[model samples]
Target: MLVELLLAAIVLVLLALVLWLLTTTRRELGELRQATAPADAVTELLRRQIEAVRAEGRDGQEAVRREVSDLALRMRGDIGGLQQSVASELKGVSTEVTHQLHEGMKLIQNAQTTMGDRLDRAAQVVAEVQGSLGKLGEATLRVVEVGKDIQGLEQILKSPKVRGGLGETLLAELLSQMLPQEHYTLQHPFKSGERVDAALRIGDRLVAVDAKFPLENFRRMLDEGEEDKRRPVRRQFVRDVRTRIDEIAKKYILPDEGTFDFALMYVPAENVYYEIIIKDETDLADDPIATYALSKRVVPVSPNSFYAYLQVIILGLRGLKIEANAQNILNDLARLAGDLDKVREPLRTLGRHIGNAQSQFTEAERALDRFGAKLETIERKGGAQAELPEVGS
Candidate 1:
């Protein structure tokens, strides 16, 4: 891989000189510094040259490490996972390089001990060492330049100039649209004593969500100032993040001032969260540092988390819809029950009248049967009187 990278550098420097600033600088510095300085001993100069190249190589490696780590924080899905894997592999490479550097240090000490009496030869050796250092310096510069190419793309994606970020804005939009307009509300200023990212409501319950992140620090650490300067800024960046958490809690988490329940300290950048808590020395237990501080329960959502929460909220909304429909159905059933009661009273009165008419018809038929029996008895008595008179004669 190093051999291929070296060959690529040669083509880029010779044919396409636009991206080969290091090669050009090396050539110019050589031409300018060309002189026969007989006063300076070559061996010591060579040793100094070697040290300088090694220092530059170390710088280049550190820069590359920071660039890759920052990239891991910005990307999502498989790209993010790949970035993480590459960062770990780079760290492994650094450990191996450190071992090699120690070996080189031992070799330098041996050379210095053996060549104590050879000043003229040492001066020539120094010249040769200077030549090697120059090449190594060129190599270091090439590595840094390639790191720059990749880091530039990372910077563009993480920048918050476009009404915050794609991830944050998308999260805010979804929360705003999910809840009913009357039930839940959304606000955006983003937790710097300025904007609240999003707000949600259900019944009398209210919550504020703020997406606060400092993405520029890692890039600045990659590209800017000395270590003494850089370390302090990085520390302050983490401290400022705590201050922002405090600000978000104080400004947005008022139970009586409209936000009920508790507020959400949304970290739209999940990678940033991992960098701070998992990679850095900070812990969740000590994150807030105050009783009223934004709780660790403050939502840490990735793009996936937001979508998942949305799915749950939709289920709740569907439940509410079902409840409303059931209430309407119950009201209709009550109205039908009242109408049925009125019809039932009229049917009962009609049944009573039918019973009275049937009883009167039965009494009239009994009276007619009694009159027929009386007539039949009278005919039988007349026939018996006629038979008795005939026997006496």
Candidate 2:
């Protein structure tokens, strides 16, 4: 477009210049015609010069037209080549853009699918969490109820009578499980009419057991958080344990009543037993409570230790019964041997009589054979006599 515009501008300028030259030449010829002498030569000279200028102008116009036509042809070829090149580049760019759009759409679809799966999983997790929260609420309520029941139990345990009764009941249950009904007596009375909690029969002797022990002081000691405050409570607990031990030892360890020298004091709770014995241990010696109980012949035993003791007693009783059974078996075997000896002579006499009878039967068989031979001889003799008589006849 710019080249075409430049070509048109050049042509217009050349035509204007040619017109101006013609106009100036016509004016000079008119001036020359108006003049007098020698005007003809000047008119001819000016006319020829004007014709030469017109010829030069026509030649210049033809050259300008040829140049403009050639330039227009060259510009057209260049413009066609540029348009094809731009079209090819645009086609390549459009193809690449289409491919990128397809890939982007695929990526978006995949992302949507992944997001949907994640949302579904999140919803399921939320539901599970809600269910867990509901279960946790139920568990919390159950724990509250259990707490109230525990408080009631604590109140009941605070009574000395209730605690003693529970301890005795626990003692009785353990005794019933571990020993035969006849082997243990509950509330066994002494000559002074004082009753021990239970008594185990070991052979002809009894081992007394006491289950009632003071627990209030021990509980108080446990409840006191500060060491200084707990110290006095602990001391009182020790005193209570010692007093119970003394009572058991004096009342239950009665040799005259067929009781063993040592008695058992049953501690219903293992922790209480631990406090009385294991927890009080020092570097110098064993726990004072355990040592004192042992000195007084009152063995303090927790439920576990008491069960183990009962197991041992059961094993000992089994051993005794086996020994008695073995003695009875030996006695029975001896009596059987003596009875067999007494029958020995009669068995010998019967064997002799059987031997004599066998010998007599053999002699009788021989005698019968001899009698058959004699009868045969008589028959032969009779036949010979008969044959001679027939000859005489």
Candidate 3:
């Protein structure tokens, strides 16, 4: 726009100059014609100079117009190029912005997927914890019930008959849990008409277990406060344990009835068993209850000791079964090895027969090759008779 305005101003200035020159020329011609003759040399020379001035003025105006037109063309071309550059820059920026937006959307989608998976796993963990808590609550109730039952058992132990019955029941329960029915019996009768609490059959030997416990004197000894009274009760307790051991030995350890030389006196109570084994801890002489019982072939056992004995016996039985199975397997393997050795002889003979057959086949092939050569020789000689080998050779 500025270039066009400048061009218009230049054209106006050229037109104004031409109009001024024309006006001056007209006035000068009027003055020259009026003051001098028409053939005057001064008047003609002035008129020619005016005509040259007019022609130069017209040429200058034409050159100025041409320059303005060329400058306008150049400006228009620059403006068009500038517009194209700006449009291309704007398009590149739009494409970049679109690409960034797409990438951001993908990242957001991935984050959502990962978050959903974590939420599902967290919900599953919460559900599993709730189930475990329910099981734990049930287990807590069972423990409470077991505690009550233990308290009732303590009360039952106060009665002598109940205590003996409890021991028998415990003995029965252990036998049932640890041993097969065929290996043990409850209140087994003998030829002497004597009944024992329980008997374990180990091979041909019977191990009698007597569950009678003398607890009154032992409890009195433990309860007595006076040393004088306590000492007497302690002595009585030791005497009672010895008496029970003697009774068990006399009744249960029967060689003629296929029982062991020694019998087990199952005390069921650990405290009583401990008292029988421990030496005197007072001014009194050492208690010889354990020694005396051992001498009489009577072994006193507490619940823990009896359970250990049962475990040992069970392990021994399992060992015997495994040993027997191993022996049978070894015998079978020996027989199989002998049978394989017998089969080896026939296989060796068959191999020798195959080697002989292969040797005979090779010899036959060579003989056929020799016979073909002889026939070819006869053919070349036009069927002439040839000497043949003797049949014996």
Candidate 4:
């Protein structure tokens, strides 16, 4: 548009210049005609110059119009091609963007599905955890009840008399399970007018067992936390055990009273027994406490060890009973042999009588055969006599 406007301005300026030149030439021609005869030739020459200028101006105008038209056509053609190229590029971009959006939507849907599945699994896990927590609560309640029962038992065991009775009861139960009624005696009195916890009869002797043991110091030793605090309590516990052993040995182990040389000190609790019988590395031969008890002729026994002792005693009793019966069985067999000797002569006499009877019977059979032969001879003679009579007739 600027180029067209400039061209139009140039054409207008050329036309104005040409009109001014023509106006100047006509004034000169009029002036020349009044001044001289050569004015006609000058006017003719000025008119030809003016016509040539006009022709040249028209050709320039035509050339300018042709160039403007060519430029406008080229611009239109370039604009149309550019518009088509832009449209093609826009279509391709739109298709690519739509494909990308479709893929993005699919990815989002897959992600949502995966998230939903994960959420479901998480919910299930939460439910399982809740159930486990409920079970844990129930177990905790049960543990609390058990702990309370244990505390009550601890309180009951604090009394020395109750503890003594409990030990005796446990001892009696073990004796009853392992031995016959006649084999064991509970609270068997001694000649000193004192009674032992129990006595087991072995052959002609008795094994005295005492169940009353001191446990207070032992319990304290276990309950004390620091080693320094436990040291004195442990020493006291050992002394108490040794004292109990000495007392049992003095009271129960009486050889004159048919009691065994050694007596049993029954400990009802395995842990307490372990404490009494534990050995240090320096006491390699045996446990020091156990050795001390042995030296006093009192043997410490826990429930388990006492049970084993009873089993061995039962087997020994059975062997003794068998041994006693064996002698009686031999005596009875000897008497049976004498009785057999007494019957031997009678049986021999009966056999002689039977032999004599068989001989007589054989002789009687021979006599019967001789009688039958005589009868046959008589019959034959009778038949011959009958035949002679018939011939005479």
Best by lDDT: 2
Global lDDT of each candidate = 0.63, 0.90, 0.85, 0.86
Task: Please write out the lDDT profile of model 2 over residues 146-259, one tens digit for every residue.
Answer: 999999999999999999999999999988888999899999999999999899998899999998989999889889999889888888888888889999988999999899
Model 1's TM-score against the true structure: 0.43
Candidate 4 C-alpha lDDT tens digits along 129-217: 99999999999999999999989988999998999999999999988888999999999999999899999999999999999999988
Global Cα lDDT for candidate 3: 0.85
Off by over 4 Å in 4: 1-142, 280-287, 324-328, 377-393
The alpha-carbon deviation from the true structure for residue 111 of candidate 3, after best TM-score superposition, in angstroms, is 34
lDDT for position 374 in model 3: 96
- Model 2 reaches what TM-score against the true structure? 0.60
Candidate 2, run of 10 with poorest lDDT: 278-287
Cα RMSD, each candidate:
45.7, 12.9, 14.3, 15.9
Candidate 2 lDDT: 0.90
For model 1, residues 1-393, the per-residue Cα lDDT tens digits are: 443465456544443433354465456446545754533465456557656755665676566556555544454445557778999999999999999999999998877777654776788889989988998899899989988975885666665564255546666676666655664555534334555666665444556777655556655655566876677666665776667666666777676655654565555566665555446643344443333233633454455566677677668767877888999999999999998998889888887887777787787778778878887888889888877755567
Give residue 366's error in model 4 in angstroms.
3.0
At residue 233, what lDDT does model 4 achieve? 81
